[model samples]
Target: MVIINPTISTQPAALTRPAGPAPVLPADRVLNAVVLGERAQHLYELSSGSLRMMAESQTPLREGEQLQLRVLGKDAQQRPQLEILQRGTQDISPQLRNRLPEQLSLNQLSASLNQIRQGENPTLRQLIAPLLSSLPRRQQLSDSAGLQKALHNSGQSLEAKLASGEAPKGDIKAALLKLLATVQAQSPPPPKAGLARSYGPSNTPSPSVHAAGSAPADIATPGTASTAKSASAPQPQAASTAPAYQAPPKPLGLPGELQPQGRLPPSPPEIEGTLLSRLAHDVKGALARQDANQLLGLHSREHGGSYMIELPVRDRDGIDVWQFQFQPPRTERDHSHNERGSQHDTTQTGWTLSLSFDLPGLGAITARVTQQEKQLGIRFDAVQSDALELLRQHTPELHQRLAEKGIDVAGIDCRRRSAQALTESSYSLSALLRDQA
Candidate 1:
């Protein structure tokens, strides 16, 4: 009877209490930021050398522009340090004032409006950076004025840049914003998307008249195509549920419930081929004329000495058949190559060409044709396995050398080593002709 029960914990009461309802989030305020482009600006300074405003007020503005406007405090090095205060839109135009949507917070409106202030930006990038930053935050804003401001900023920036000698930056944000504003301002919002009845005098029908209960004769009024069609053609009885002004079941291609399906048929092959060929021809011409100077110009980075013809050989017909090749070798070795050689063996590469040209015609024509061959070599303690294989396949001597270095000749890719012994130990008949010349 004296044993204490160990069932209940001491903190049981604390764990039983209920938590309060989750806190509600505050509603987001609407914002509108104007779109703009970066551009150069002419700034005005007071006699004290404090930036008063931008010299050109026609350009779209940016946050950097405000920096340009502020008086700078001297730094430790006596360099000007920028300090900026936020600006509002009391000085903006009335049209823009009217365009500002009432739902936007004052801060949002001011921020948006200030982005397009004239004379503030020197570059479109500077002007539009703020607006571009705001796009990812669009859901936070609630009003159309922000949208309008963005549009106005973009349009003004584009116009100013165009008037200036500088090219347009083709900023997509500005373009889109201006386009949206133009559409909103020029095109009326679509009529509310429902059946709207216009009220008029009792004798006059509603603007959107419907005759749900009317007979065919009642439905088709005089001086109308419907009336004439009903009179001429035997018409099926209209559906009981359908109104007299049910828009005649919408003709083919009209937007309605009965939409045709399946994708459009393929274009004709002949027409497509002709168009493609014409386009190819046009592209060839354009490519041919494009940047003619670039074609003939030498690559600046690959500078080497020029090549010139020395002796010209002509045929019996007075036409030039061939010319001697001459190029002045570079006097100095590349410094970069010397550095690389410190770490690795410097590989020497060179090319030689064997050429013959034919001149067959009457006026001292010399018939010549040219063939070219190239050889490359590198000095290494051990060549790459792939290259060694090629050498072994080409030359037994190279394979034997590789074997001396403990490499297998049977595993090689080449027929044999590339080097060859002199043939007949004498120059060929063609070489003799060139030597004699």
Candidate 2:
């Protein structure tokens, strides 16, 4: 049986301070890691070369699991803290395959644009030649202007081509797709200012019509001799020579069509609502099936929002009761006022996911996982030190279970909290769920 020390002292060693600055690890720096062993409070001792440090994780790690970790910062004793970034090498292949098609299209567009920008006389006509015949007959008359201009600029015999009727229709659709991608990659010129109107015959004022007394009284007094004379004059026959406003030339592609930007648009309300609904349904299904594996996959802590899931996993000791609570996405409005009537801002973008479990011999345990920006932090309640110590002994198993559900265990922290505080926290979560129901 493995026994873990209840507490480890972390005070600075008694020595004169080194001159200059403390050597620090770069933030979010990635390092390859291998699990060495487990220590107190579910912490795993990890190594990279001569560097050895402890990391706390909710997910268990096997004795020799290879992993990548991003350095967060140094703990109190100056040991580097790291968060898991990725696991085994093969894990990312499927995700890359899912995105391969889009990546390929983007690569092609980038290459073509780079060639054009370098002034290479690429076969512009040949590039779009196949697209000409596939255009709808009606759209051909309208949308074919850009194509015609491109061909003409390339000195290609467009009329002769039409006469020959040799355009390959089968490749037209594919050519159009490529052309669309290229156009989207290019940045269009800035829009021209709107037309300016010229007032006719500056020598004569245009007739000023207004509601009675709407203008200043002096301007409204048209009956005055000078005003009547000015109004009655033939207005110099109003030179009738205003320049017509001409619109700026439209870009080569469809007029007034904005090129698609790279960023994704926000999800529509219906889609967001559907996602939440589906998530609820999936969670319910997982629970009904009594599948811890499925339930683990259903926990979405990234997007934020309340989620509850039960994990029923048995170890050598007994069945453990695992409960998860995810705080709803908190917005700026949520932090505008605290009980003290002062304004505060929460810089954290990600929500919190709290895990609570009951170990047969170790009493209650709570682990709070928080992600701020890209950094991950895990904090355990200090009231249940024994539970955490016991967990440390089973670190490998815990890591494996969490990994099965797609959760990455990062740095672990232990903080003291009173029983009252735990109760208050649970109450808030309970209230949130009740309101949502």
Evaluated with TM-score, which candidate comes out highest? 2
Q: How close is every model to the real structure, measured as TM-score?
A: 0.14, 0.24
- Model 2 scores a C-alpha lDDT of 0.38
The C-alpha lDDT values of all candidates are 0.25, 0.38
Q: What shift in Å separates residue 322 of candidate 1 from its native position after superposition?
A: 54
Cα lDDT of model 1 by residue, 40-125, tens digit: 33212211133121122222233222222232333343323222234233212121112211111111212222332222334433
Question: Mind giving the per-residue lDDT tens digits that candidate 2 earns over 164-189?
Answer: 44353333223434455543344232
Which whole-number lDDT from 0 to 100 does residue 141 have in model 2? Answer: 23
Please list all clashing residue pairs in model 2, or write none if there are none.
Answer: 42-392, 59-398, 59-399, 60-398, 60-399, 60-400
Candidate with best lDDT: 2
